[model samples]
Target: MAELRLMKGNEAIAEAAIRCGCDGYFGYPITPQSEVLETLMARMPWDETGMVVLQAESELAAINMVYGGAGCGKKVMTSSSSPGISLKQEGITYIAGAELPCLVVNVVRGGPGLGTIQPAQSDYFQAVKGGGHGDYKLIVLAPASVQEMYDFVDLGFELAFKYRNPAMILSDGVIGQMMEKVQLGDYKPRLTNEEIIKRYGSWATTGKTADRKRNIITSLDLDAGSQEKFNIKLQNKYKEIQDKEVRFEKIACDDAEYLLVAYGSSSRVCQKAIDIARGKGIKVGLLRPITLFPYPSKAIQELLPQLKGILSVEMSAGQMVEDVRLAVNGKVNVEHFGRMGGVIPTPNEVVEALEEKFIKA
Candidate 1:
């Protein structure tokens, strides 16, 4: 039987990582996300499962540690907030270039500099697009609540190993800090050492052996043609993911005339907004994307043929709205409402914005 428990998002992630058979975790403490480290520390998976947990000197070191472990075919992970993630970009690029499997969690915070410790969605573009200087994409999963935070660890690792690429859990401070009821999913171990050796043994530097060739994992391509070939492979993989890996949630969309598109914590706010709109006899619905990178474009496009308008409520200024617009194909009116710099809007605020901009003529 599966166990149900009340946990904060950060705690859930730590628990899920252990249950998922994650081989190692390397991270430093950062606000809003510091609880992840604390939880993992308290659990002490190292003593029980022999899983390695290290608090690196910095975010850069933590990510590099992840790269080191992944290169050895270990199910590794790292977590940080926005600024710490910014520092991990270089390491992320390195991991992607090497076609390694690892999980990264970014509990977002405000801004370009030393932003506030509060939540912000400003990292949407960074997470969806390549944060580092490269032609690469990370499998980005956006979690709306504490349950998804736990659920996403298994999902993240699965996607990473499936594509031989890095995967990220793109959460924010609110989700990380909020307490919620979560179902501790069935304890299913992801991969055995024997399985790892059988599948990824050719490249992973487990040890030197006379039967195998030396492996050098790197992104350095001297020849343009060689670099292009690598890029082509990555692009092909991304296309496959786009086609088969997208996941999202739809509420009251089948009979709705107006739709609200949002993700992460903002989607929760939109849920409240939908309830308010319905209370006033306005026919509104919601489409929440769980996989932000393999965005629910097809779903949005399908909705366009039936819905009259879409209001995208986000915590960023307007990053996701552009994607919504493109998916709609100019078939219907699409508008945006947002707040930035770590300011979370209340349900009433969202309702008023919807009324002024979308519902009330």
Candidate 2:
């Protein structure tokens, strides 16, 4: 049986990390997400689980710590808000280059520079489109509720290790701070160091052994042909992940005339708007993204033939609207409806936007 408890999204993430047998956590505090660090500090997973949790001097230092731990072939993580996460981009790129598995959480907040501490999905592009330098992708998971916050941490680690890549739980202010009843599941660590090396030692830097020569883990392929080959392999991996890992929720989309595309906190509002639109006899539905990086493009394409148009409701100006456009492929129109800063639009506002943008047409 699953145990039920009221938990904040941030607290659930900390607990999930312990359950997943994460070896280390390094992070610097930032608004709308400091509670994650606070919960870990109070719970002290280090005492019982032998996990190392460090409050680094800055987000940059925190991510570099993840880099170091990942280099050791250990399961590790770091987290922060938008500004702090921005600082960690260089380290993120390096981690991807090394093909080291790790988890990163960006409890997103609005921003071009020092954006508000309020919840926002403005970082959608940054998370999915590679905020760092280079052609790399992170396995970005967008959690719409506190329950998802707990659930996706373990899944994130699994995906990261499986691909020798990084995964992110892209959350927002509402999910992080809001308290809700969450079903706590298993906490056993899935992979051990010996097991990890056995499974991934083809490239991981375990110590040189008698049976074989020294091994090096690096992203550098000086030979152009080798680099291109390496890129092709990565592309194929991304394709495989798209097929197997993309996750999303569809509410009445089968017959929906006007679809609301949302994730994170915005999805909550859209949920209410869907109900309200239904009450008014408007055939509205929702497409909530659970894995933002994978983008749920296939699902969108599947429903494209049925949709009149998609109204992308987000906390940002319109970060995710572009993805909706790509998925719809001009078979149907896509328009964005959102509020910037910290102000969450009311259900009425969202419903009205849907009516004007999609239903009226």
Candidate 3:
């Protein structure tokens, strides 16, 4: 039976990692998400499941460790807040270049450089648009609830290994610190070395054996032509992921004249605003994006015919609004309303923004 517990979103991430048989977690302590490392420390999963949990000296070190672990076909992950996530970008790009599978969690805080430790969706572009570099995409998953925070940890790794790409759980402070009753999955055992060799030996840096060719893991090639070909291969993989993995939720969209587009914590706020708007006959619906990279562009385009305009509610000044606008392609007016520096907009505020930007306009 699955265990039921009241767990903070960050804690749920840690607990779920252990339950899902994560091979290792390497990260530095940072606010809004520091609890992820802390929970792992207190639990000592090394004692329970032999999972390696290490707090590296810095965010840079932690991400490199993830790169090494991933090359070896291990299920490794790292967690951090916004600034810390920025520090990991170089290594992230390297891991992507090598096509190593790993998971990253960013429980975001306000930021432009060590900004407030308050919740914010400011990292949307960084998360979805490839924070590292090159033509690569992190299989980005946005969790709107504590339950999703728990569920996505496992799902993120699955997708990562499925495509041999890095994945990210783009969470924010509001969800990280919030407490909720969560039903956790049953425990899964860590894969043994033989199983790892059997499964990922095709690409992972297992060992050079006579019976099979050696596996070399890297993102570098001396010839520019070779590099271009590799880049094209990566692009093809990204297209496949985009086609097969777009996930989102639509609420009250039927017969709606306007839509609210948001993700992560902002999506939760919009859900409340939708009810209040519907009560007043505003006919506002919500399109909550679950996967940020495989963005629900088609989903938004499908609703363009019904939507009068879109009021994008976010915790940042405006990040995701660009994507929403691009999805609508001027078929409808798209407006943005948000608060920065950790300010979370109230449900009433969202309704008012909708009224001002779409309904009243």
Candidate 4:
């Protein structure tokens, strides 16, 4: 039987990680997401499931710890807010270059610099466009609700291991702090050392056996030619993910004349806006991207013919609008509507923007 509970999104993430057989968690506390580490510490999964949960001195140290654990074929994760996430980028790039599997959760707060502790979707570009210095991408999942907060932890780990790349749950302060009902999934046991060796010994840094060669996990190749080859390999993997991993949800798109493209908390606001627009007979719909990295570009492109315009709604100053425009390719008018620095726009405000930008225009 599934366990049903009312919990905050950040707490759900922590509980889900333990239930999903996560091997370890290393993170430093940050606003809007501190509950993740707190919950983990409170539960002490280390005593129950033998999962290693540690709070590092800084976000930098935490991400590096995740990198070290992931190299050993263990399911590891870390969590942070915008500024803290910035500190993890270097380690994230290294983890990607090493082709190690791990999960990262960023409960976004307002930013540019320590801007605010409130919710915002300002980090879309950083999450999807590789914030770190490298030719790499993390499989980014944006969860809009507390239910999804629980669901994506398991899915994120699955995708991470499948691609041997990092997977991130890009959430925001609203979802992190808001309490909601969640139906927890069945518990999955952590894989044993022998199981890890059997499944990932080819690349993971498991101890060498006489029957096989030693495995190495690294992101360095001094040879230019070899480095280029590695880059090409990473590019190919990204392409494969783009083809196979795009996820999205469409609401009232079939008969809509205008579209709204959004994700995370903005998507929830857009949903309400959709209702408002429909009530006013505006025929507006929403397309919510679930996977931000392998974005639903193809889906957006296919919906272009039926739509007269698109409004890329966000909680940032129009970051994702660029991607929507790139996908639309000027087939129709596309505009952006947003409120920045932790201020969330109301449904009426989004509807007004849609009216001004698409309906009235």
Candidate 5:
């Protein structure tokens, strides 16, 4: 049976990882996200489900550990905050280059460097626009509530392996530390080595046998032409993801004259803003993008006919707003409103920005 408990968002992520049969978790501690490591340590899934949990020496080590595990077709993941995630970018790119499936959870904080340990969505470009090198994309999921934080862990794994690429749960300190009631799923047994071999033998680094040649995992090519072909293949996969996997939610959009675009915790705030706007006879709605990379550009374009303008509300220095502008493509007025350095914008503030940008302007 499923269990219901009041768990912090970070704790819910850990609980969901264990319950979803994660083979291993390798992570280092960072504020707002440290509970993920702490909760996993307290739960000790190794004893219950034979899951392997380790406190890596650094974020670099943690991400490389994920690479090593995923190469062997294991369900692996890691968690960190801003600066820590920056340290792991090289390994993250290596994993992407190698086309390994894994999960990376970034409980984002403010920064271009170690800015603050508070909640912020300033990592939008890093998470969605490829912080690493070469050409690659991670399947990015933005969870707006605690329940979603719990749910997206398994969903992240599912998409990672399905696409044979990395996936990220891009959250912030607000969701990470906040406590909410979560319905935890039943425990799922970790996959045995034999099951892994059986499932991914064709591509994974399973053992060599007389009947089959050994599988090699790498992202290197001595020939430039060969590397170009490989890059093309990756681009094709990304195109497919864009087509089939764009996820979003539309609230009160049918009769809306203006739209507010936001994600994660900011979207939650915008919900309240929508109510306040509607109460004042303003027909405003929200378009919350759940998948950041496979963004809801089309959804924004679809609502263009009814909207007089669009405002993107976020906790950053206007990152996602660029994408919103591209999607609108000069068809309507688009603007950005945000707060940085860990300050969250309030509902009224959002409305004020909306009115100021679209109404008063």
Candidate 6:
């Protein structure tokens, strides 16, 4: 039986990493998400599950550590808030370019630069649209609840390894800090060297063996033509991911005339707004994208015929609204509603936005 426990989202992430057989965690302390590292330290996973948990001098060092561990075919991860995630962009780009498999968690706070420590979804663009400089994408998962915070750690690793790419948990400070009941699953053992070799030996930098040529891990190609080919390969991989991995949840969308699109903490708020709107006979529904990178674009497009309009509810200054618009393709009106700098908009406010944008308009 799964163990039921009251856990904060950040703590759930840490515990899930251990239980899911994560090989290593390297991170720096950042507000609203520091509990992730603190919980890992308190558990002493190195002693318990033989998972290597280390505190790095900075976020840069932490991400590079993940890059190094992932190059060795290990299930490594790191966690940070907005500013720290910014510091990690260069390394994240490198990890993507190298086609390394690892997980990154961004428990977002408000930011253009050190904006606020409170919960906000301002990092949606950074998380889904490649905050790093490069032609690359992270498999971004937005977890709305503590249970999902626990669940996506394992799922993130699975997806990361599936494509030999980096994955990110695009959470917010609210999800990171909120306490809720979580069903903790059983422990899974880390993959052994033989298993790693058997699975990833074709590309991973395991020790050179007589059966095959030495494996190389790098993100650089001096030849422009070769680099372009590599970029095309990456683009093809992203298209495959988009085709196969789009994940979302629709609530009361079947009969709705107005749609509200959201993810992470905002999705929960939207759910409440849905109920309130239905109470007022507004016929509002929510479309929550669980996979932000492989966004539910097709799903949104399919609902376009039924929806009078879409109000994108977020904790940012309207970042994800762009994707909603792109998916809608001017077929229907799409507007944005948000609260920034760590301010969370109430369900009432969202309903009001829905009324103003879709109902009254």
TM-score of each: 0.97, 0.96, 0.98, 0.99, 0.99, 0.99
lDDT, candidate 6, equals 0.95
Residue pairs clashing, model 3 = none
Candidate 6 or 5, higher lDDT = 6
Candidate 4 versus the native: TM-score?
0.99
Candidate 5 lDDT over 23-142, as tens digits, reads 999999999899999999999998999899999999999999999999999999999999999999999999999999999999999887889998999999999999998888999999
List where candidate 6 sits over 4 angstroms from the true fold: none
Reference-based lDDT, residue 83, model 5: 92
Give one digit per residue, the lDDT tens place, for model 6 in 83-155.
9999999999999999999999999998778788999998888888898898899999999999999999999
User: Model 2, range 144-177, lDDT digits (tens) per residue?
Assistant: 8899999999999889988888999999888998
lDDT of 3 by residue, 1-361 (tens): 7678999999999999999999999999999899999999999999999999999999999999999999999999999999999999999999999999999999999988999999999999999898877888899999999999999999999999999999999999999999999999999999998899999988888788897898888888999999999999999999999999999999999988999999989989999999999999898889999999999999999998887889888898899999998888888899999999999999999999888876666
The order of the candidates by lDDT, greatest first, is: 4, 6, 5, 3, 1, 2
- Model 4: per-residue Cα lDDT over 219-262, one tens digit each: 99999999999999999999999999999999999999999999
Candidate 6 clashes between residue pairs 3 or more apart in a chain or in different chains: none
| Cα RMSDs, all models | 1.3, 1.5, 0.9, 0.8, 0.9, 0.8
| 216: Cα error in model 3, Å | 1.6
> Under the 3 Å rule for N, CA and C atoms, how many clashes does model 5 have?
0
TM-score for candidate 3 = 0.98
Model 1 poorest ten-residue lDDT run: 185-194
Q: What is the lDDT of residue 285 in candidate 5?
A: 94
Which whole-number lDDT from 0 to 100 does residue 332 have in model 5?
A: 96
